[model samples]
Target: MASKGEVHVVHLYPLQMSIYGDLGNTRTVTARLARHGYTPVLHRHHPGDPFPEKAHLVLGGGGQDSGQARVQDDLAVIAGRLRELADAGTPMLMICGMYQLFGNAFVTVDGDHLPGVGILDVTTHANAKRMVGPVVLTTDFGEVVGYENHSGATRLGAGQAAFGRVRSGCGNNGDDGSEGARTGNVFGSYLHGPILPANHALADALLSYAVPLATGRPFEPAALDDAIADQARTRQIRRLVG
Candidate 1:
């Protein structure tokens, strides 16, 4: 059990992954927790490290195909544990490659299939042409702004709740207006401008889920001055819209 004011945030595969400033997500999480008066205990899990037994939140970031391949086996080993955490209501934010790997499977452009952890009922098919640009999404939390760069087009299972509706840019796939998938406390998305820094509402939602599970009490973090974040989001949304 974590001590009072101590929240454990596990960063999965930080060394092997985190392409496109994905590590910034972890920094954002830590900063938010600290601002809310909680001590964020960051646990970085490398290839060989065992997954921590107690985690309030888990963050996984975007990676390239080669990076994904390198960590696939290690990820497979911990897949079951991840499912357990999800069942226990631990908040998870999986971005890009990590999001694909959390699903059923990802088929590469070369036709090789990479087995996923099956946390989300989705499948990704790699395309020769990559989708790379600023993305705007209207989510339950609010308007989310980020950038996406991926070759995988992910399709959610029937009846699965999407993280949001795509307002602009190619989401999960260019075909569906749906962007990302959410199951319970787990959220998977291709949005990779580190996500949380600009989308503070989504960040707070993740924290709302985590603090309760970690501290054995419901928590609503004190609101911070988000004017700058809002401005950044507005600029991104405008760029995407224009």
Candidate 2:
């Protein structure tokens, strides 16, 4: 497979949504892309900036409710462009706060309504107690794991499909076994182990979709040693499962 000369990676609201090592996902993606012989170009899209004209993979991180409020209007400003990208099969990974905003709306405890981009068929409400802990999930990528700390209970719509099923810990909502929302290649989850570092499959899948879209070249992955990450992931999974 031919390598893409470059893949544009867009990171939204990095400064505001850097909670719980969320920025690690961006770092991990770039690092992994390098190993695959592709140059990863990063573009940071803050509130009011024009959405990058070039984007292969888009990422967003976790943040507090307050942070979400701060980005609410800004997200609205770029929602249309994001929706367009999603429809075009540009891979997107939205965690926690971003995940909530990508939904229909996020209802605060005070009955305040924060509108969302409606990319995912889901809604979040601040009613359930905070669910914070390590999580293990059964997904199409096999076993995926991460950490989640959020009080905003999310519910997937009837027409929606979950990103994975929770095997342990609260996911989406305390009542549902679902862990995240999925619309085409757009994925929304609360996982925060900088997520990509702990889940290689997810990261690689995003890159596979990205290279072709960005440079019209198929993604040819190289075999890189992930022994350290694999070992760490194994220990965490064991601790959680045990």
**Tens-place lDDT digits, model 1, residues 108-161:** 988999999999999999987889998999999988999999999899998888
> Which portions of model 1 show Cα errors greater than 4 Å?
1-4
Instruction: State, as a TM-score between 0 and 1, how close model 2 is to the true structure.
Output: 0.97
Q: Tell me the deviation in Å of residue 13 in model 1.
A: 0.6
Compared with the true structure, the alpha-carbon lDDT of candidate 1 equals: 0.90
Worst 10 residues of 1 by lDDT: 1-10
Q: Backbone clashes per model, in order?
A: 0, 0
Worst lDDT run of 10 residues, candidate 2, spans 1-10
Candidate number with greatest TM-score: 2
What TM-score, over all chains together, does every model reach? 0.96, 0.97
Q: Over 4 Å off in model 2, which ranges?
A: 1-3
Instruction: State the lDDT of candidate 2 residue by residue for 168-218, as single tens digits.
Output: 889989777999988999999999987898789889999998989988878
